[model samples]
Target: MVIRLLREQEEETENRGKKGPFFLLIFIIVFLSIFAFVFPFFFGFLYILGFQKVMGCFPCTGQSKKRTESGVNNDIKRKDQKKPTSGSLKVNSNGNLQKEDAAKDDRLSLDARNSNLKDQISENEINGGTKFAFGELVEATDNFSSNCFLGEGGFGKVYKGHLKRLNQVVAIKQLDQNGVQGIREFVVEIVMLSQADHPNLVKLIGYCVEGDQRLLVYEYMPLGSLENHLHDLPPGQKPLDWNTRMRIAAGAAKGLEYLHDKMNPSVIYRDLKCSNILLGEGYHAKLSDFGLAKVGPIGDKTHVSTRVMGTYGYCAPDYAMTGQLTFKSDIYSFGVAFLELITGRKAIVQTKDRGELYLVAWARPMFKDRKNFSRMVDPLLQGQYPSRGLYQALAIAAMCVQEQPTMRPAISDVVMALNYLASQNYDPQTHLAQGPCGSPSRTGAKRDNDKAQIASDGSVRD
Candidate 1:
């Protein structure tokens, strides 16, 4: 009712635009009052988010959801499900927690698995080279000392090490061997990473598997990750400029495209997030971490079924709810990551809008409303970027993260869209890199003013 009243008043004011300030003021005041009544959800959310710090854990930065994709009753359901009852399930301490931990042994065993990775990679070492031994790695990383550690993850701990033979730095990812799933994840990464080579992809140097230990070695990424650049920087550090942000996004898109149309039996990079995106000195982006990657069939099938596992906000709604994985699934994740890159915000957030609670859901509303879209541009850019570039990039993203899996753009297509968005720059040398970025910026880059041009569609042509 309030919305209808506001709409009618807006129409009246627009019709009365030639009249006067008094008329305008009457219209503005009435519209504001009506909007106040209509958008309480948005305002109430802002009040809680802005003023109420004690409201509990705000999931990520902008994550708020009334209903879960799990289909569990989010609303106050039955008395039985409202709260956990001790009588319903026994809470065992030492025994049960141990079993759960044991089940998670592989997922949690990164530290323990580092010791055995030498044996695993020996079999898969680059065609002809001295097989790396455990003693050599220990020495490279300062005898497995704390100073060499880069970061820890579910697979294992990554350490910076000096390769004696190569005389260069390397990143060693040690995997936990206690769980079979971890072992499987390790094997998949080993086989896939070795064969895959692209400029936008981190190189898989070697592997390590000794008894219950497993590890993955790759060329070290010196500049850390985009996540650190976007969120972890100090106050004085310059945020990623619009050009760098576009480059990073465009490069990552190329990597995804490589896994999609470019590869023989396409691989699905189910996990796409800021942390997995590594940067070189000049802010060149490389997509890494294939632990959750899936190699799927090529052709007319709409999608392939797989377990639903991915980072929270980056996961596509349909794929997360149903275990259907496809090349488009990765596109959806890229879309989320793209939005994060553009906004200089995390995919998750605590914010003023209820639907804006989740970045994607919140972002969709602004896309259709042209005025609202101006707000979507990251505040840091300061109007320096062209609005058309921002809209076109977001439009490509909007296509990627749509609720329908099939409707999502292919990673190859996404690369082209992003390219046009970046600068309409095209290079043949970059294309030979076979990374996703090499794709034509516009799938059908055309001249609008006078003539029609042949659409590149999927193939890049001069």
Candidate 2:
């Protein structure tokens, strides 16, 4: 009985020892599993907190990056603006005193514009010019009345207004909210016109800027634009006389000459259409709209590479094709305008007459033939223009419209030729009289025939 009791006790002890180790192992596993899940939650919370702090130190978020990019773009735009100087002209002589006096006036005007621009645009961004009260202009223009409406263009509508403050008749050009010309163009036109003061160039009286409201005030042109008289005339208005056309051409040429030759660094008048040529009382022509003008190439540079921008028919062929602009490009455009005056035809025409669709294409061949040269002259003149003067005018036009830019005459040379034509007298009967053989009809036919005869005789001998 004693031996059996001792054996049972030993077996129970062994079982107890094994069971204790197995329970301990299970407890350790349960603790480890809970720790694994809970630790991830705690670590994630800490990581998120640290991420916020890091983002605050360095702007790496999408919104912060976009703001940084916008700031840089604004800085670049501000830098590109050409701020006008307070004193643009210097007084060297009595001839320049008038220009100096005008500069003083411009300076005063600029101060006014700067004051007004302070509320809307940055003072540095806005160039110098006169700032008129929008309320005053509203009153002058009869509350933007349609009766006062004169015309409309790519910029906006123009209205004839009587400024009570200045006691002056002014033409107000309001900016179109949806027009091609925007703030950049408005500022450019104001700054350019402020510096340019010439009899043949339209004058900027003042301008009004109020938030989105933009208006330019100019001297009222009673006779309206040359386009109106030349192409689209109002009822009862007589067709422009030959002398008047000549005068307009000469004056317009002088204005271009000033832009090309007189201005420092020279200015290329990109848009030189008939409509841009405004006429004051007594048929005085003035070049209007300088928004498209660019500073010409300087320091031996042949041409300025620019995106081709101008009227279709007026753009120089080479400039249009290659985007290389020069002073000669303007000369080519001027030639087209001169042709418009001579032919009384539109720039781009679709006619039933074969080979005469475009004014330039049709006129090119006629310009070569002496007898057919008279065909190029405007029928409106009623054959009243001086034949010698017409010949001189056509010759200049031919040289200007040459396909080769180098062959085109300079604006100064064109001005000189025009000046002579303006001064020279014309006798209709004598100019158109036929020669002894009636074969030489035009003024220069006889001389041209003589030259041709001499050339033919020499060529035959060779």
lDDT at residue 227 of model 2 (Cα atoms): 79
Q: Per-residue lDDT tens digits of candidate 1, residues 49-151?
A: 7654643443333334533332234223434444432123233764321123333333212322343543433333323113365667777889777999888
Error of 2 at 75 (Å): 23
TM-score (all chains, Cα) for each model: 0.62, 0.67
Task: Give the top-scoring candidate (lDDT).
Answer: 2
Q: Model 1, 64: alpha-carbon shift in Å?
A: 83
State the lDDT of candidate 2 residue by residue for 230-348, as single tens digits.
77556887887667788888999999999998877588898898889999988999998776787799898989998888888888999999999999998888888888998788878
Off by over 4 Å in 2: 1-128, 352-356, 427-462
Which candidate's TM-score is highest? 2
Global Cα lDDT for candidate 2: 0.75
Clashing pairs in 2: none
lDDT of 1 at 312: 83
Please give the distance, in angstroms, between residue 148's alpha carbon in candidate 2 and its true position after superposition. Answer: 1.5
